[model samples]
Target chain A: MKEIVVVSGKGGAGKSTITAGLSYFLKENDILVDADVDAPNLKILLEPELIREEDFYSGKQFKIEQDFCIMCGRCYQECSFEAIEIVNLNYVIDDVACEGCGLCQFLCPVNAISVSDKLTGKKYVSKTKYGFNMVHALLNPSEENSGKLVAEIKKIAKNLAKEQNSSTIIVDGPPGIGCSTISAISGSDILLLVAESTISGLHDMERLIELTKNFKVKRKGFINKFGLNHSIDEKLVNLFESKEIEIVGYLTYSQNIPQYLKKRVNLPEHIDGYKKLFEGLYNRLMEAVG
Target chain B: MNISIVSGKGGAGKTTFTILFAKYLVSKGKKVLINDLDVEEPNVNLFLNKKLDYDEVYIYIPEHIKENCISCKECAEKCLFNALVVAKDFWLVLPELCHSCKLCEYVCKYSAIKGSKRVIGKIGQSFDKMLHLLEGRLNIGESLTTALIKQVIGKSLKIKDNYDVIIMDSPPGTSCPVIQASKDADKIIVVAEDTPFGFSDFVVLSDMLKEIGKDYYLVINKYIDGEGYSEFASKNNVKVLGKIPYDINLAKNYSFGDVEDIDTIDFDNIYNTLLEG
Candidate 1:
């Protein structure tokens, strides 16, 4: 099966809107993955029904056995992270502060500290109204290992696609050029970059484009809110042409989007021209992916 | 005092605010040290038109000595991250997956395993009269950001007590890096816009700060261009430090590296409120 990832350098660039519309346009049984584990909103638009949920754990946490504690204060001093703190008379480990580096566990003369797995987040597999599978996750607040969660979500999507004999997988990736974005784009057949028309937007897009090039993935560009600045839009078009990246389409500023977002409804149905625009974009994307 | 300019979401003017804040402090005759903790994309240096002086930060990972190796497979079994793959003749280590826990070395029965250091990223520092900007740049294709952030923050700690005010520009999201940067702060100013996205992320960030026991104030940016953020702030009982109206000239000048005068605008009031808070 082929996969396409939709990513933007900055937030609020209509990445989820486009992903939801495309998911609606794709044939039934296709898979949709929301790799934005932090603050995932694709389900709000797609309105997926819960099918299954599983807890995911990436790293371990250090726990000290109080009975064996000697109040040596060695763990506090040796910990590179100030995960340990003195509460009352006993030392306690702040699970959030603890990096699970094992230095405290190894250095404890009393062998009081031990590492155990902690739940980081939960992943969901659901059935959307469009008759497709949706795989997404919500990382716990102040949790780490988002990139690992992204990988797990994609793995589940791939397995679901195989089990259902689906032919395509579309992913709504997170913003920023971080480990999570890299995990979402890795091994993808195509990447759709949705960039805004602002100076900082252009600069962030440059960094994201450089990042995508490192993975050697085929890329296409779309200028979201093209009406923000006409000159910047022209400059972006030229930049795409110079880089040999195709400018698939442009989306002008529209209140209909935020309206749909507020109501948690799909765009194509609520907006007047969004359906046609997305249908055409979907067809073109299929052709390009082929 | 160490102050951090942070937002829960990306592109919310963290770097822009840092530069302008540095210029404002310099004009006020206060020495400032700006540390950019957004190691994944260190763009503060780019805006300043200065190259970073790089110093390597190393992380230890297990390496097997072939001569002393035993085919026991104990190291692989003890590895929780699945970083060690035991083969018939030897074991292979996946450096990226390794959390540098040193468990493989401890579990080795043959004394074959040894820990070695690898440079995951570098700490870069540059200085002006009023500002000493330090940034950590994680090497491309490297996934270990928390380690690099720790190194950068550790190095900055030595000189942080000297400066009158050390301003830190943190990475987006309430993850490990954000916690690391905000851990030692005297106070935090969360810069957010008046939008659903901004408000939602602000709640998440506020919860994080409260859990970590840090004192914080909120600044609603682009308030003149929109509304709703104030309502959210009031309903949540988040202290309002200040507000910056939506101004194209301010944004343009900031993008071009000309620090717009915060005193000429309402930002000075915002800074004063934060200082008071």
Candidate 2:
């Protein structure tokens, strides 16, 4: 099976809109994965029906066994994250500050700290109305294991694709060039970035391109809101020319944005121009994967 | 006062609103320091007139000394980030994946694990008498985003007394990096729109802010009719701080990089709540 990851270095560039569109277009013979665990929006568009669910534990956390406390203060000095603190004359570990390092447990002279896996996020395998299987997740608030959760979701998507005998997998990625984006794009066959036509858009897209190149992945892109600024649009195309990233599509802003977004429109069924636009995007994708 | 502008979803105009708010403060004769903590892609400098260049910032990682190796796998097993690998004859440490938490050093009984510096990103600063801008740029393959963001915020706390107000432009999402940026802020302004994705993501961050008990306000950036976000804001007991109408010319000007002295969008409520109040 082939994998395609969609990412944008800048937030609010409409990466979810494009991913939803691609998922609707692919329909069958493909699996969709939402790698944007922090704030997944594809579920807003596709409306997937839950088929399977699982709790994801990436790292470990420590619990203080107060019954066997000595208050030696050695755990406090040995802690790397400063999670160990004495509150109200009682030793406790702040859940927010803990990195799940398990060092406090090992260094506890009284063995008062016990290490256990922490629940950071949840994963779901669902079926969309379009007859496509989807894998998505939601990282709990203030959770830091998003990179691991992303990798886990992608692994499930790959296994589901193999079981269903599908030939393609599309990933909706999180914005930024951090660990989560890297996990989404690391081994993907195709990278498609949807960049807006603004100054910040170009700047963030340059960073995205640099990140993709670091992973040795050739990225192709589409410019959202092309007519907003002709000069900047040309500069974007010129930058693509310089970087050797092909420009496969250009999408313009329309009045139906709010109207369409309100409906969570993923399919191009109602929009006239999008049918052709999605076809063009899919065609370029097919060509690249082939 | 240091206020951080954050959003759970991307393209919600965090950078746009931050720059506009900074400009408004400068016009009001308040010394401002704007720090862009979105090290993954620092783009606030794109709107500035001067060239943006950053000095390299490095983080500590453990480099294994083979002669002192006992191969007990203690360091490898106790690592918090799973960055170390132990083979029968060799050790592999992935520097890019390290969190620089230094847990490996504490676990080592011997002094085989040596602390070393690796370039993580670049931190840039530009200033005049009135407005100062500091930006963090993470190296392309670097994974230590929260560390660099913390460094920028940590340093900002030291020299913040020199400026009347400091505005932190945070990265997208409600994760570690965004939390790190918001933890130190006096107040947070979440930039969002009146859409489903925007509403849900805003609620996510709002819940987090409420849970953490941090002072925060909501700003609607691209409000068409304010149907979805307004409902969410009212339901959540959050005060609506400001609103920017969805206008094509404003977007065009932003695209063309011409956001100087243009008062197309009114930020009066925001100014009153954040500055005057």
Candidate 3:
């Protein structure tokens, strides 16, 4: 099966909207995955019903055994993160501050600190209202293991695609050139970037393109809000021209799109011209993947 | 006062607000330092249009000294990030996967693992009149975002006393990086667009903020007469600072990187209210 991942280096550049549109257009042929585990929003567009759920534990967390009471501040001094803090006069590990590096546990002379598997997030297999299987996850707020969670979700999506004999997997990726974004795009057949026509958009998209150079995947794009700035649009087009990335689509600046999204209406189904636009996006995607 | 402009989702106008507010402070002849903590894809310098002095930032990763005789897998076994691999004859340390925790160096019984510096990104600073811009940019293909952010914040904290107000542009989402950026802020201004994804992520972030007991206010961007965000802010007791009307010209100006005197909202009032109250 082929995998197509949608990502935007800048946030709110319409990655989810494009992913939702692509998934709707692909229909039964594609299994959907939302790799933005921190804030999964494809569920808002697709309206998936939970079919299977699983708890994801990826890293280790150090827990202080309160019964073993040696107040040696060795662990506190050696702690690089300062995760070990005194709360109510008891040396406790601040869950938020802990990086799960297991240094405190190793340095604990009294063997008071023990390590346990950290439940970083939860993954779900759902059946969308539009009749496609979707694999998504939610990284527990403040969890740093989003890259692992994204990799796990992609694995599930790939397995589901194999089981269902689907020809494609459309992934909605997170914003940025961080670990999670890297995980989402790696090993994908195609990388569909949704960039906005803004100065920051061009700047961020440049960084993302720099990131994608390390991966051996086909790069394609749609410049969202194209008419917002004609100069930036021209610059984006010129940049796309310089790079190997193909500009397959351009979405004009629209005020009504956000309004429609706020109401949870499918763009292609409700909007008059979006049907053709998304159809073009899907067609270009198929041609590239093929 | 340290003010952080954050967004629940990407592209929610955090940078836009940050530059606008920084310029506003500059107009009033206040010493303003803008910290762009969005290391992964920092774009605050795009609007600055000024020459910035650059400094390379590095993270330490363990380098295995191959000739140290023993093949004890203690370092590999104890490594939480699984960055180290021990083979029969060779050892591999994936620098990209390393969290720079120095655990491997500490765990090695033999003096085989030594810490070495690897360049992660650079911190750029532009002192343009009253406005100072400090941007942290993570090297492409590098995942150590929070490490660089910590460095940026560390530098900001050292010289923050010279500035009247320090405005930080935090990366989007409610994750470790966002939390790291918000942890040091005196107050946070959350920028939200009035869309479903925006509203949903905002709810998630606000809940996390409340759990963390962070003092934060909401500013609606590209607002289109929407009561959903305002109602939720009221219901959740979150302060709604101001709303930026949906103006294509504002977007256009931002796109052109010419935000010198673009006054879309009452940034002065917002700053005064946040600082005083």
Give the best candidate by DockQ. Answer: 3
lDDT of 1 by residue, A92-132 (tens): 99887776667688678999987788898899999888878
Model 3, span B1-277: residue lDDT tens: 8998888888788888888888788878899999999999888888877688999998888888989838888899898888988977779888878888788888888899887898999999886648888889898888989899999999999989889989999988899988999987888999998788888888889877887889788899888876578788777788888888877778778878876554668877897889787
Expressed as tens digits, the lDDT of each residue in A235-274 for candidate 3 is: 8998988996789998888878877887898888777699
Question: Candidate 1: which stretches are off by over 4 Å?
Answer: A9-14, A43-51, A71-82, A101-111, A126-133, A163-165, A214-216, A225-243, A252-276, B109-111, B224-228, B246-259, B262-265
What DockQ, between 0 and 1, does each candidate earn?
0.29, 0.70, 0.77
- Fraction of native contacts (fnat) of each candidate: 0.23, 0.79, 0.77
Q: Give all candidates' CA lDDT scores.
A: 0.78, 0.83, 0.86
Cα displacement (angstroms), candidate 3, residue B112, comes to: 1.7
Q: Which stretches of candidate 2 lie above 4 Å from their native place?
A: A214-218, B51-53, B260-268, B275-277
lDDT of 1: 0.78
Q: In Å, what is the interface RMSD of model 2?
A: 1.6
TM-score of chain B of 2: 0.93
Which residue pairs in candidate 1 collide? none
Q: Can you give the lDDT of residue B196 in candidate 3? A: 80
True-structure lDDT of candidate 3: 0.86
Model 2 agreement with the true structure over B1-277: per-residue lDDT tens digits: 8898998878788888888888888888989999989889888878876565567887788888888888889888877777899877688888866766777877788787888988888888885658888889898877878878877887778889899989999988888778888876888999987788988898888877877788678888777777777667677677778778787777787887666544555666577777654
